[model samples]
Target: MNGAQSLIKTLANCGVDMCFANPGTSEMHFVAALDSVPEMRAVLCLFEGVVTGAADGYGRVAGKPAATLLHLGPGLANGLANLHNARRANTPIVNIVGDHATYHLQYDALLTSDIVGFARPVSAWICESKSAQTVAGDAARAVQAARSAPGGVATLILPADTAWNEAERPAQMLRDIGPAPVSSQAVDDIARLLGNGKKTTFLLRGSALHGAGLEAAGRVQAKTGARLLCDTFAPHSEVGAGRVPVERIPYFAEQIVDFLKGIEQIVLVGAKPPVSFFAYPGKPSWCAPQDCQFSHLAHPHEDAAGALAALADALNAPAQSSIRVPLQLGGLPKGPLNAMSAGQIIAELTPDDAIFAEEAATSGMPLLVTLSTARPHTHLPLTGGSIGQGLPLAVGAALAAPERKVICPHGDGGAAYTMQALWSMAREELDITVVIYANRSYAILNIELQRVGATGAGAKALSMLDLHNPEMNWVKIAEGLGVEASRATTCEEFASQYAAAMQQKGPRLIEVMI
Candidate 1:
């Protein structure tokens, strides 16, 4: 078999059956190999960023790596911002980037750049196949690296000569690397801390926020009177009214400092040490109290659920009764819009089992409290803090759980980053209700300007952050991309449109003019 065929078969063997791609001339042979292999489904993207970001979203919801095929360095560069976000979110992705042939590189082509240098910041593992015989081996390794730990991006650069050349049979199966076990000593330390009855909180994220892990945490919290908080920007949070009710650490440093004021100890479970996302001039980077003792009950790679379960037993906490969920629709807003907002829509229109992909930027802050009342729903925030992740994430979530309604509450500025996802939603018939907050400017950047003390800026300086030039008409944009669209000017209209969109089959877009 040719090297490209071997690589394709290897990825399929590893259970990565879907690929998002934007190819160029250098990838012709790989494209040809893909054509012959009907088992692998390649979804086309107009831009490389869409391809990479879609793969990132797929991994976030699917819990496995998805492949991305891009033209060499320039293409990878175009996708780097989203890749950076993927790296931060730790979503597993296998990037197959096509490069110039060995002989062609000596001629100094315009497309050439330092591919490895560009990939290092985003990829946990990166390699370029030296020969056809090694392509399959590299592909297998890339998959393994991507699937490791909390999941990560792995890039494999392929030269044109290697793609058309003969290679050995592809790896038929992947090695299973189970989640890491928690350290016995760490558990023992945390148990002692909880015994002291001092003011303490258990901070959890990633897998610790869901399933058996969260149940274990609830039991522990119920028995011990310890508080539980999730990281502010977690990729997926298994939350809502009845499901443990974790308080997220405040995004602002001052608020966090106030929250942690008298806390004696902080235990982390599958989460990093709590800190501000950005630094304020006079504030300390770390938000926890200076005297607070820090401990990790379970690291990200460790089996958080197992760790929590074992810790609960060690602490002798009783298993709590199953929580109850109310199966009713919340009341809708009335009258004209008048800044009734995205938070209001989420609180009023969120159906049971709704999945929310929130990339609403600053407009999302109010949603934290209002939607906290919405029971039995899953909320996924932009883990990597990348702007364009929402729509694609909604697509992936809809595809992942077809029975559940996926709601994407997005800011118009951020939505523009990967708006092409609307086309994919239409093509794939994903059950996603995309609600765009049409403020028509990067409102978050305006906040950032003041937060960073950029006051009294000139017109041209301020104009760069505003998007009112043509004032993006999201309704038209969604329709142009083949998705059915509507506009809602008030909270009542938004709630009505959102409910209608949620009940309907296939993709729909709601432009909520906030």
Candidate 2:
């Protein structure tokens, strides 16, 4: 067998059956190996960013790792932004980065660069296979590393010679590893804190924001009068009617500080202590008050849901919380095409079990609030501050769970960063509905400039954030990419387009001119 074939086969044995790829000359052998390993389905993406982001989305929803085949150092660099998002989200992804042959390195090839340096920031585990004999085993190890504990990016740098050379068989599937066991002592301590009668809040992330963990948190909150709040941007969480609701920390530092002002204590469940996204003049980076006592019930690498459930059981908490959010479908507003009306339309019409991969930026906060009372669905947000992850994330979510609908509600400026994802959706025939809230500017940056005290900025400075000189015709863009598209200039038009797109299957785009 060739090294590339064995590597693909090993990945398949490890349950990473899907590969999102944007390859080059160095990766030809690995690309060809796809035909040999039928168990691995290879999906081509036009941009490396899409390849990485799609894998991120797939991992968040499928609860496993997806492989990404990137060209060389530059290709890895192209995908690094989304890799940053995946790292923050703790999403599992096995990256196979192709490199020039071993002997070719000394030649100082034009494409040559420090691949390891580019990978270090994002990868939890990284290796460069020296020989064909070891490539398959290395690939297996990459998969294992990607899925271990809290899950993360694992990179295997494969040289072209190693990929083309003869090799032994594929590696056997490694032993499966789950999240580390939650500490019993820690659980008991948190239970006592909950019963201490002090005002406390639970800061949550990871699995604790969804499914069983979420339910346990609700039960704990009902039994004890504490509150449940997730970070401003969570990796994955089940929200809306019938589920235990979780309030998200506000994006602005002042808002989060004000939000956490009165809480006397905080217990973490698979989450970090609240911190501001950025430092502001005369503003604190730490969101929580310094006097508040803090404790960890579960670390990100531990079994958060299990720990919370045990805490609830220890407190003899009720099976269900009385604070479950009730269904509140809104009557669509007919006047203006704006964030509030558009948000209500999308929220009220969102189907159960749907997946919303969102990077709506300045236009998303109201939508997030409205979505809390909509149908039960999984929500994936930009965990890393990166803006371009939304469109490609929906691609992976749809592929991982094709039976469920995947919606990408994106910002016009950020959406431009990875617009090629639309082509992948059309090519893969993924069931996704993309809503483009085209306000024709990087509106968030405008707010940021003012917040940062950049007063009296020139027209040239403001022009950098504007997108209006040449307005993006999203309808034509989507059509050119092989997806059906439509435009909505009014609230009524938006309601009709969004509703219709939701009812259909395959890839569809709706541009909301706000």
Best by TM-score: 2
| lDDT value, candidate 1, whole model | 0.83
Clashing pairs in 2: none
User: Which residue runs does candidate 2 get wrong by more than 4 Å?
Assistant: none
lDDT (10s digit) by residue, model 1, range 1-514 = 9999998989988898888888999898888888767778888877777788778777877889899999999999989988987888888999989999978888888998889998999999999988999999889899999999878999999999889999979986567465789877877888888988689899987788877888898888877888888888877777666787688887888898998889898888888888888887887789899889888898888888888888888888887724423333346666666333557666766777788888878778877666776757888888776688888778767766778888888889999988998988888888888888888888888877888777678899889889998889988999999999999887767777877876788899988787
Cα RMSD (Å) between model 1 and the true structure?
A: 1.9
- Could you give candidate 2's per-residue lDDT for residues 1-514 as a string of tens digits? 9999999989988898999999999999999999987888899999999999999999999999999999999999999999999999999999889999999999999999999999999999999999999998998899899999899999999999999999989998787577989878888888777777788999999989888889999989898878899988989999989998788899999999899988999998888888888878888898898899989999889999999899999999999888888998787889888988889999978789999999999889989878989999999998899889999999999999999999888999999999999999999999999999999999999999988888789999999999998999999999999999999999888888888888889999999989
Best by lDDT: 2
TM-score, predicted candidate 1 vs. hidden true structure: 0.95
Clash count for each candidate, listed in order shown: 1, 0
Q: Could you tell me how far off, in angstroms, the CA of residue 172 lies in candidate 2 after the best superposition?
A: 1.2
> Looking at candidate 2, what is the lDDT of residue 229?
93
